[model samples]
Target: MSALPRHVSPARLPEVRWLRSSYSTGANNCVETARPSAGPWAGLVAVRDSKDPAGPALLFSPASWTRFADRIDRL
Candidate 1:
C-alpha cells in the first residue's frame, strides 16, 4: 500500500472536491467524500463530517475504500 497521511486537516486539502450522499438531508448530518485530484494525495479518498467541513478528514487508499464499501454493502 502506498504511504498516506492517516489524517489531515480539511483546510490543508483545499483541492479536494467534497461530496455528500444523495440521501443526505438539510440537517447536514452525513459524511462527505472527496478524491484528491493531484499531488501526493491523489488516488486516495478523503472523508469528513459534513457538519464539520473545516475539521479533520480521514484518508484511505482506493483499494481499502473499495473493500470497506463492499463490506458495508454486504451487511
Candidate 2:
C-alpha cells in the first residue's frame, strides 16, 4: 500500500497554504489545493472543498494530481 494517507484533517496541517482556482467565483463552490511542507503529508498535494475548510483534505502525489488535472482539462 502507499505510505501516503488517503485523507487528513486540514486543522493538522499548519505548514500548508490552501489556494482555490482562479476560475472559481464568489460563490466559493470550488475546491482548494495545498502542498504539505512537513510531516507524513510532505511532498503531497492536499485537496479539500472550499465550503468545508475544516473538513477532510484528500491527499495525492504530484504526478497523480497532474494526471487528474490533465483529464479534467480534456473535458
Candidate 3:
C-alpha cells in the first residue's frame, strides 16, 4: 500500500456524507465512506474512521475499491 499525504488534515477536507456498512453491528469500530457527489473529485471514494469523523481519509481508485471489497468479503 502507498502512504497517504501526512500534511492533510481530515477536518479541513470537504464535507461528505459518510455511510457505514449495513453489515456493521452496533460497534463503533466500523469504517465510513463517501464519494464526491460532483466536481473533479467525483468517482473518487474516500474512506475514514466512523469513530473519528475528522480522522485522515484514504482515497481509492474505482478498481482498487472493487478489489478491496472483494478482499473484505473473503475475510
Candidate 4:
C-alpha cells in the first residue's frame, strides 16, 4: 500500500468544492473538506483551514479521514 502525499496546493486541484461542517460557527475557526473526484487526488479527502481557502491541503484516505473525524466528535 502507498501513502497519499501529506499536502497539496488547493490551486492545483481542479474544481474542488470545499465544505465545512454545519456545526461550524461563522468564525472561520474550523477546517473545510473536499473530496476530489478527479486528478491525482481522485477519491481522496482534502482538508484545509476554513480561513485560508487558497492554502495547502492535507490529503487523507476516506477511511482515515472518517476515523479522525469520529474520534474528534467523541471528544
What is the lDDT, from 0 to 100, of the residue 43 in candidate 3? 70
**lDDT per residue as tens, model 1, 1-75:** 556778998777876788888889999999999998887787789999998888899999888988998998799
lDDT of 2 by residue, 6-73 (tens): 78888878868889999999897999999988987788899999998989999999999999999999
TM-scores of all models? 0.85, 0.91, 0.75, 0.93
Alpha-carbon deviation at 11 in model 4, angstroms: 1.1
Give stretches of model 1 more than 4 Å off. none
Q: What TM-score would candidate 4 get against the native?
A: 0.93
| Best first by lDDT, ranked | 4, 2, 1, 3
lDDT of 4 by residue, 1-75 (tens): 586788999888879898899999989999999999988789999999999988999999999999999999899
lDDT of 4 at 29: 98
C-alpha-based local distance difference test score of model 1: 0.87
RMSD of 3: 3.6
Better of 3 and 4 by lDDT: 4
Lowest lDDT block of 10, candidate 4: 1-10
TM-score of 2: 0.91
Which prediction has the highest TM-score against the true structure?
A: 4
Count of steric clashes across candidates, in order: 0, 0, 0, 0
lDDT of predicted model 2 = 0.90
